[model samples]
Target chain A: MSTPATPLTDEELVLERLVALLEHVAADVLEGPVTDTGPGSLRRLGLTSVKLLEFLVAIEDEFGHVWDDDVEESVIGSLDAMAAHISAAGVAPAPTKRD
Target chain B: MHVKGIESWDLAYDGRQALHRTEDGSELYYELRGAGGPVVTLVSTIYVVSTAWRNFTGNLAGDHRLLSYDLRNQGASDGRPAEFAQHTEDLKSLLDDLGIERTYLVGTSISTLICRDFANAHPERVAGLVLVGPPFSPRGSSRRRRIAKSWLAALDAGGPRALFDLIYPLVFGDKAIAEGGSGAYLALRERFLAINSAAQLRANLREALGAGDQVERLTSIEAPTLLLSGDDDFSTTESTLDATAEIMRNAAVEIIRECGHLPYFEQPEAFQDAVARFVASVEEGTFPAPWTAPATEGKDR
Candidate 1:
């Protein structure tokens, strides 16, 4: 019998979703695979100003999070930070339609 | 930044940069360079900031007093959106504050319309006009409308970067893009992203799209005018430039080959040469004398 897979925690799930969104939005300019979730990881993954803005928009669209004009950069400084910020803000993912 | 060694053109080189408060209280960011020769005021397109004319300013500043400014809603300037008339007034205020008696205006793209309106409004203040890639019709074509709509949609969806990607091809010619290659393109993209934001670009576009046909206004400009167009510029054709020149009292058309909407960037030397020649012709009184249309031509003969 095969061992059962460990279920992902809520934070892990958010991180996974954020990575996916970054990959989708940064396909063209990404330098390498996005494995790191530490601070400045977005910049490390080769997200420039343009791609960063697109990624922010994607995050808002996916998570229903509206960024304030004066939002702290540290909140968006890394994948993990963004995930934590999203969870901390109590932003629920937008409801998806059943196919 | 993917590219290295790209020199910074953001700062004023030997000149002074300042923000002038218009009568309406909007701050207009402007740069004044050089001094002795004729004043050549550089007007920017909605997409770019005053530094976009760095090449032009560098080339002409040695001989001419260069005045380059960011209109409201442009780079390093206030984000307040204003119409063409408001922009014209701001230009007047800037000139007054600088003690500029008159200037030869060099404007590109949507700003060309601003130049036309300014020349019409303050005919005495304009010594000559260099209208680059001017839109001939006030009422744009259906195709133009479709493009504008798509641009707005792109801006709404992904911000200024998305809008830049959409317009990059349309704005530059094949020669320019091919020559610049990927590195050059990336550098330009970085600069554009640094200067522009979605909300600001959206406001500027709205004002640009609402611009009226200034063809009638062209007739009122009596200053020596050069309607400059890039041969590869799809936005405005040579025929359109010729027709626009016909409407003015003293106007001529100059086409710079292998260039697109922005000639100074693509073919700087050629653009500089053309502008220099025009200015020389005007100063030397060698420019073509104003042509008078035959009275019978407009009437049903």
Candidate 2:
């Protein structure tokens, strides 16, 4: 769901998009409740390493920006961190593929 | 007991090799042997099929109804693209087809991962767990990914023979390779070569490496578990078993000396003794938790 001409900065927009993407990608595990916050560790929410990898790949495929191999694991540690990484990498939103 | 070639020995038991169809139209071949006893099902290692457990089944079949099966796209089973969930589903379907209410599970290598997954998802169906030389992803995600990539790259570069050659030494004990008077090593090599194929290897590799982390779910497993490893094995060391057992409520670790990854093959007597003793203890309701018993007291090393 896209907001029309919302008064949000580019970084804010990227954060919003990432939060939506993560919630969408991990709906199976994270659907019951918002156990962890935007800055909290996703591992506590039961996002396994395999699921994390799949989430990263989905992010890459949707944004058309390859995740750098050297990127620290902390980048995906939380929604805020992931959004910051996306902003720093200058990734733009592309058409999402329904996996 | 000098057998010439593996062909001469009749590996098949009565009521052997039947296919059960899955919802996706894939047929999985399973063998049922012995009867009127506690049920035990063998989960095959990634590299070999049901026949790999023929001798092992012989050790347990007299007192326990034994079941063994070939994983999908391997051995006599029909080919389907491999996925982690498919293995669990195929196993669930096989157990249903055989009318087995609950069973003790013996899982080797990658199949051990499947066993844990199946148990976590359907704890009521699993009576006990026996894990042998199972692989687990290490600490880091990238490192784990790299390990999987390196394995696939080796397979893609030189195909199945390369994969076989790389794994053979690690799986068999160095002592066995150097001093087992019999030609078991060569025979095993021949079997590996005969079984190797591009599609089969690729599918098995995918299944082996694609399994998700079950470490967190181990605490929920209500079944008593026997964690086994070879003393000389480079993979899945005793420390690994200890870490795994710490989470399990009723778990014990057993280490077989002078063997490698495949303790059941290299040291069948020791393997059988450990299994028999464990099963007996479980049946008699005397199996001790790891906290109470000496670490190495379960069976003679």
Candidate 3:
């Protein structure tokens, strides 16, 4: 008998979506394919200001979340951090299709 | 050129600032200052406001009627996602409402496109034209389009502060950045962030970026034109400005050294002097002379 696969939790879903969005928006800026999605991984991605903004916008579009002007730096330090912030804020994935 | 009998009316409107509602029901904030000379309407760029023209107004107001205003979707103006041609129409309505028959138009950056369209549409009403940092060159439009996309994305991501941080280096020259220092830069950033919301900027940028090619329309502008460019302007260079001026029947190039995209902000005195001299020349009917290469061009080298 085959074991059933476990469904992803809300936090896991957010992280999955975030990684996809980041990869799509930051493909040009990123040196290689993303191999890490752990905490503080974003800092190692070497994103310039323009690429960072693009990633932020993509996150907003994908997660239906708006970042506060004074949002803590740590909240965007990595894919895990962003997923955690979005989940804590009770944000859901937007129904709109990603470009 | 003699001052029209509109002096009394101009004086009454001088120092008067108010909102003028267009036929489309959008309210535009305009301020009239200085009187007794030809009206010089300062067209604000997508991000700039009337208040940002304080340097230009203070310098030229003594001899020029200065009219500065925020276009729709900018500053205190009300409207969003307006069509490109709507701004041209708004200019017409504003001039008509103010009873101004003819005027000199000074437009910077994206607003230069607006001024060009207005001049082409109403050549009789344009006494002179000053296009500063016009981004109309086909050679530069693609690069500008890419930068514009980055700006829009920045605004959507972190509002005006993010956008400012991204564009600060491109908008201001090296000299201005070095001289202004971090404190001044921070202060300017605060002021910019406080101006308009992200939604407003998005609307303006969409309309500006979606605008069609206006290169062919340059030949239609018959007013005595002065194409101003900052030496370090990345969006449009001095050679581009020279080429643009060559397309027009009556146009000249004036490059301000040590300045970037915004000469009026970075080098006000130089900007003012160039404009004043050009306006004076146009008034005296002494400009737009036939083009000629220097007789000693090869010998000088």
lDDT of 1 by residue, B1-301 (tens): 1112122223222235588988777788888887568888999876657866775456677788888898887776784677757888888989999999899999898788789888988999998999887765534344444666788889999787678788888788777676554434544565575567676788888877776664578887888998887778878887877777777788987777777888776666566666776777788888855422223321111
- lDDT comparing candidate 3 with the true structure: 0.74
Higher TM-score: candidate 1 or 2? 1
Q: Higher lDDT: candidate 1 or 3?
A: 3
Estimate TM-scores for all models.
0.69, 0.67, 0.69
Q: Cα deviation of A31 in candidate 3 (Å)?
A: 55
Interface RMSD per candidate: 11.2, 19.7, 18.1
Best by DockQ: 1
What does DockQ give for each predicted structure? 0.03, 0.01, 0.01
iRMS for model 2? 19.7
In the range B12-105, model 3's lDDT, one tens digit per residue, is 1123469889998998889888867889999998767876676445779889888888899887788656788899999998999999999999
- List candidate 3 segments past 4 Å from native: A1-99, B1-16, B138-140, B290-301
Clashing residue pairs, backbone N/CA/C < 3 A, model 1: B138-B213
Q: Model 1, range A1-99, lDDT digits (tens) per residue? A: 999999986677888888877777777756666889998676455444445556665777888877653344455567888888887888776653312
The CA lDDT of each predicted structure is 0.72, 0.68, 0.74
lDDT-wise, the better of 1 and 2 is 1
Q: Which rank order by TM-score, best down to worst? A: 1, 3, 2
